[model samples]
Target: MREVGDSAASGAGAGDMSAEVMVAGGVPLRRNGDGSWSEPPYPAVCANGHELGPYRVTIGVSHCRCGILHRTAQCNQCGATYYLPRPTDRCESTALDGRHG
Candidate 1:
């Protein structure tokens, strides 16, 4: 089976830290540039007490009609989907009109 988010950049374990991201595996870190990903990075915590993270490129975002955007990560440990507040300029995500946190 193919591992999720197993891209060429993700495999660069410890390449150019500048060009490569610790989350070169995560969605936000996939973008190639020279700037901060966020002022305060969003957390990827699941209720299961395990850190939710990117397993593949299956991450997404949901935007509430109230204008709260959430960044998402699927738990590799429990196969659960966790949503954190979406920081600006992270991913070109699909928007929704429901509220989720």
Candidate 2:
């Protein structure tokens, strides 16, 4: 329900962006027949021809025990991706023990 440009500092004073994620009919997006929720308005294209849209929040990075991190988006070409909930002040992510381009 929140615009991609909407933010906590937009002067609307609606609180942080994290507090405003909702689904269909304000019912909250749920799992589809394929067991995946309809894309949250983010842009995504999978190798398998899966196209998603408008993700509210992007998974910046995910920390791993191997001293690596992962990103939410994966390259359709190489079939590579990462996880989520990375630490603060860090945007660099690790995937499959290598760098992603």
lDDT of each: 0.46, 0.40
All candidates: TM-score: 0.33, 0.24
Query: Over 4 Å off in model 1, which ranges?
Result: 1-39, 42-45, 54-58, 76-79, 86-101
Compared to the true structure, candidate 2 yields what TM-score? 0.24
Return the lDDT, model 2, position 41.
29
Candidate 2: minimum summed lDDT over ten consecutive residues — where?
7-16
Clashes of 1: 3
- The segments of candidate 2 whose C-alpha lies over 4 angstroms from its true place after superposition are 1-44, 56-60, 74-101
The true-versus-predicted C-alpha distance at residue 30 of model 1, in Å, is: 19
Best model number under TM-score? 1
* Candidate 1 pairs with clashing backbones: 4-55, 4-56, 5-56
